[model samples]
Target chain A: MTAARAQEPVIVVDGVSKFYGDVLGVSDVSLRLGRGVTGLVGPNGSGKTTLMNLLAGLIRPDEGRITVLGLSPDQPERLMRRLGYCTQVDAFPAGSTGRGFVVHWLVASGVAPRQARRLADRAIARVGLLDDADRRIAGYSKGMRQRIKLAQAIAHEPDVLILDEPLGGLDPLARAEVIGVFRDLAADGCTLLVSSHILHEVDLVADTVVLMNEGYVVAEGSVRSVRAELTTHPLQVLVRCSHAGRVASQLVARDDVVELRMHADRGGFVVSSRDADRLHLDLERIMLEQGATVETIVPADEDIQAIYDYLVSGAGGS
Target chain B: MSDGRGPLLPAPSLRLRLAQAAAIARLELRHVLLSRRAASVSLLAALPLVPWVLAAIYGTPGRASLGEDLVGFSHFVDGAVLRLFLLLGCMLAFAGLVRREIENRTLHYAFLIPVRREVTMAGRWAASAAAVATIFSSSTVLALALACLPHGRPAVTAHFLHGPGLAQAAGFVAVIVLATATWGAVFLALGLLARRPVGWGLLVFVLELLRPMLPLALKRLTISWWLTGFLPLRSQVKAVVGIPAPPPSPLAAAIVLGAVLAVAALVVAWRVRRLELAYSGG
Candidate 1:
């Protein structure tokens, strides 16, 4: 984590709840986000977009309060100057060029036209869309549209950016380039709340994550910390060694190991342990004692996919 | 996130607010004046020019004198240009300002800016009013020139230079401007408040059309009655309609129209301030 993530919160949501008639949007969603990239991960209809909308002042919270950069969303004159939102809606004004889209929004935010143009060009370049910046947005591809939206959101140099599914339609190379941009921005102390369905990408880009399910945040904090707190589910590790039988025998007898199963080919074994640190130490000691040539020792259930499967999908629930 | 540097920018001044509004107006003006909707408004505005152009080419049916032609032109302006074409044109222009954006899911762009929503609404209203007024006012002028064309060059010059022709043209332009400004505000507010602003705009048009037959007190409430106070041929209008009451003084009419404009602007501001982004059925 960067030092920027250790600073005071830039966005504070206190027991916020929203409802759309009989439907629940988000319920009791409270979060404190510092300066850095925070992935907002949830399945569809999990209220991730709703929470972002509330922060962006697209909708008012029905039951609680939120503040971004110490200003209420209702105070848009002050809040919008510091906050930027790249909404998931993939629509633009008809007949607008990509550069015109960014520059017009900047000018709307009180930036002078010349400065807006310069800043728009800079931002468009940052998103790697300088070549297509002058093309009409209606002719842009889906990924190009997403990049232009990102360009407009960052054109004003806002302190906080709330991006809903910002990386949805991107190809692999563009996704990596966009992830690099996020990293660069986070390193410069900009706070970003990014929501995406690509869980592994979220794991790659975010320093912390807020996981939601059914309109409620089920877990939050750094991925490792949240994984550590899930004591009900044991951590799984895949061990590959020359002497799998010997290593399995040694690990199965350990107090930390709860379950063990040998691989079908008998070249390795999967071990479930209550304590990952202890399991790693035990594997190292056993491998040395048995003269086992261990080729790979991988944590099988510590990533975001496992966490999402365990918490959101209720897979193998104990 | 602020780096302990406090705000990177100061609170926007009133001048900045006005500049933001002007920027929005410039963008919206381009759309209103160039979009397919603009073409429709142009067609509506040009409707009055057709008969006048034909008269200049083929002459009037009875070979009417200049005085009679002027009287006929006055009626045409009051009835076709002002009552029918201007009303429909403003409806098409102003009511589409917010409604079209909402339908297109583009209103959030303006809402996300660091300016008040009222400023956004005002900017859009100003653009619509300017576009409608420019198109219809230019049409009115061309129609007047064509109506006066077949009366011979010397007589037409004397009528325009020394007679009431200049004042009449100016009155038509003033009425167009004032009517567009006031009606544009009302339609803008309706666009925010109503799900179907065209229906509401047509209802308003119906009320405006019925103003001549209403009681004096009720007539005073209609935009048409107040606009009539500026008509150069008020006596000709009165002679035909035979209404007993005198029209409101020009100053009183101006004040009433100004008051209506202010009220409509306030409604627009209030409605837009409370607006939430609900674009599902837009």
Candidate 2:
């Protein structure tokens, strides 16, 4: 766990289980999210959306309790004022303009009409949709729709934001811009729980991560910590050198090296090491003793994608 | 985006909730007033005026005097406008209050707001009732005016000024407003509870049509029975074939209508409290 998790949690879930009849939505899930972006990473049907919905009070857990900002999800009148959710559902009311949609929500939430317009404009500009603010949402492209949804979610300037795939359907530039916005919100002390299938993007924006699979939280924590906790699945490292067979023969004998495979090109070898820090320290000595010319030493499994893959693919063990 | 305004009105006051509800009502009013459904309901509300206009322009066979015309108009208002047109119009307007949002997948937008669900339901129902009531009430007035058009100015003026014409017009407007309030709530509740609210609305329409033939106690259970007590002209029941039971007193009618409205509102609040955005199944 990161130091952020040790802070006063703004959101707390305890033994939360949700079901749609006999189909499990999320089960036995527990989490504490403090200030900053906590990425909810999961494959499809992995209960990522369901968990977000539960926190946003869109759906209630059949068997557990959740509190956001010390208030229960059931108390929407109190909870929703401090919370904002950008749902995955893409549909909007027919004939609504982007600006009007945001303003309508603000007004409906009791913001004064004049202030709602001002805030709407600010939010539209924040999402970089000022050029299309007055345009009908039905005429917008998918990426623009995503931006408008984000604009509405933040128009109220909520204390806690729950985003379900807020980055879906955006181009690389827009994605980067939105990630910058997420960082800005987190910097302002907003607690954001964002869900995304794009594991690497989550890695970029989230301070901590929760990995869910098949209706369960398989793993969660800082990316490095989660990787460190998976002892069974030793960290994989790609080592490029002038002599692959020599490096593999030397590394395979080490106590920390669990497995080694020479690259197909015979110019490099992939080493699985239980102790990555120790492996890194010995790499220079091993290269010097063999008179090997080392090119690259990259930890292949240090990022969220590899961690997600290992955890989700069952290679890391239950 | 945080202007550092601190948290939103920490505990929303009653005035704040009312403001939120009013805002919702305004938004819902636009949807109910501008849609194709509104056009069809407006046409239905004005349908009773069509015959009156035709009769005013071209005299009918054995055209009756102004008094007889007024009687015939009241029966027409009772049978055609209130029973058929207004009933269907309220069904069209109110049953779609929640269902339309679900169909558009926009219900979550309202549900996510800090306002209470009960407040949202009240706001939507109020807007729909206002729209439907205004349409039918205006049509009723026009129909009454056209019914007296064939008569000379002195006679028409005397009918409205000295006779029961003005009273009948006021009574029709009041009954229309009350009927809209009560029936709108019923249909709104039906929209929340039923998968196919229109089908359930059809069932309600049939039951109302069969109300006059039911036993007196059962007749008291129908909305039309309580509303009939408020009609100024008694000719509507006199024209019917059976020996209709005595109508309830105006106070009793008001109390009964209020009770039905309260019950329907309670049902709507109960249903909306648990309403989830399961748009996929819908």
Candidate 3:
């Protein structure tokens, strides 16, 4: 799937903006996605799914244009033939067997009958549900249901697979297995846009990250770049102890400890520093010398949650 | 494959859309047959007619009589049963369609397909209509066959015993089916257009039933006007009722019903096209 073909940007969403009456889904969000996996990450309402929908040709953008594989989404004919969308919402007809459902999608994707069968089996097996393929979808667990959706999306070998929260409700093991499939898809140069609130999930699979908040693109760049922008200040390490002054006094000597705030409880103090190594060394040495036992060290270097909170609360203007 | 030219069939792919719709319809049919609720409702639908059928067979003034009075009497009974059957069938079908989709949220799978939303809708409509048609046709056949049995009333069998009479009876069945199909489309469209199609259908049904009494051209506002116009039998009899009227030409009424159904189906298509897979708050 990868080696024989030249890389091409299959999806181009330029200045795409959409307002659902009053609520905004995506605002002035623009990105050119080519082969490989791109993770769409943001807080719950951060327009990640909106951006994906825009690119998938599910929703028309009010202000900007979107092209999927060089076709407008509004023009359903040309665009949908090549696109496969897995919605964030996990739903399937209750009565269909997994194999029946997968076969239906395979046939629907325009695969030849023989090819459809082969593809359906391959996709079902790809999702690691071959044994359960004949089981009724109604009887399948949520994890199994998710895999069924995945099988449908991949059965046709779509050029671009746009998934919204595909990993939701899966156990850790299932999540890993699904993530592995996503990684394989990316490695095969199949363009994939995965929208998830889990930062580590995205961090594991995507080279690029698009961050949205309140229907606007707060940030869009390489994962490293976004991580760097999020890492403006050093992690704040709050150490709890009986002698707060003693801990603060030892921390003040090191240049690495840039900011210090005494804990309100007087039992500990919070120290901010970019260098984790120096902070840990300083804390260890100071606690040993003072014979003060450190209760806890909490490093808050704009954890994904903090970044998400900032994006959400600060989502004033798109 | 043409250079910069749009393909006749668009995204997600037509093949997938058809497959998805077929799968949905198949699942819906299975649900209709296997569901306990569906079974009970279907049983209830057929329940009320049993006593009326028994009465028509045994309660006539004389057991062996064969004459015009029996024909008139049979027409009255048959007409009432036919109307009741269609009305209940339409209501049940419409409510069933809306409730199932709303409860299960299974519509999400269909929404993912690239075909026009109407295509998916048409598939479901066809599926339901096929089921309903089968049920009604078999029931009518059974009713006709039973009417000919030895224990059946002589007047009932003697009236419809001949070939031409049987053909006319078949024609009557055909007219009833055509009318029901048009109403089915209307109801199915209503189901797609509203969240509570049955409630809305009832409200509209009551309004249509009463609207005919209003002055002049307003009578045309009711679907029943067109539907009744197509019936083989007239609602009122001149001797029994005060003012009797001739039945309208079935051809003209069918044309009108067909056109209205087409327009309603188009509206359904348009509504489905705009539909989102959101569970609620659309």
Give DockQ per model, in order. 0.49, 0.46, 0.14
Chain B TM-scores of the candidates: 0.90, 0.91, 0.72
What TM-score does structure 2 among the candidates reach? 0.93
TM-scores, in order shown? 0.94, 0.93, 0.76
Evaluate all candidate structures by whole-model CA lDDT and list the values in order.
0.85, 0.85, 0.65
RMSD of each: 2.6, 3.1, 7.2
B1-282 per-residue lDDT for model 3 (tens digits): 212223322345556667656755664566566655445546644654575478656655445433333345345333444445555676677555654765776665655565566766766676666566556655554554444443345545555764335764565466556655676788877877777677877875665544434443554555555555543344432224322334446676778878988987898878666654434221
lDDT per residue for candidate 1 within B1-101, as digits (tens), equals 45642343347789988987898888889888889988999999999899988888998544887778888887787778887899989888888787688
Task: For candidate 2, give the docking quality class from DockQ.
Answer: acceptable
Candidate 1 C-alpha lDDT tens digits along A1-318: 346545779889999998888888899999998778899998988889889988988888998899998889988888888888999899999999999999988877777788889989999999999999999999998999999999988887788888889898999999999999888888776789999899999899898989898889998999888888888899999999999998899888888889999999999999999988888888899999999998889988878888888889976332
Q: For candidate 1 chain A, which ten residues in a row score worst on lDDT?
A: A1-10
- Positional deviation of A16 in candidate 3, in angstroms? 3.7
lDDT of 2 by residue, B93-195 (tens): 8888788888888898988988899998888888888888988999999988888888878888998898877888998899899999999999999988898
A123 Cα displacement, candidate 2 (Å): 0.6
- Model 2, span A41-64: residue lDDT tens: 988889988888888777788998
Docking quality tier of model 3: incorrect
* Interface RMSD, Å, model 3: 6.0
Model 2, position B59: C-alpha lDDT score? 64
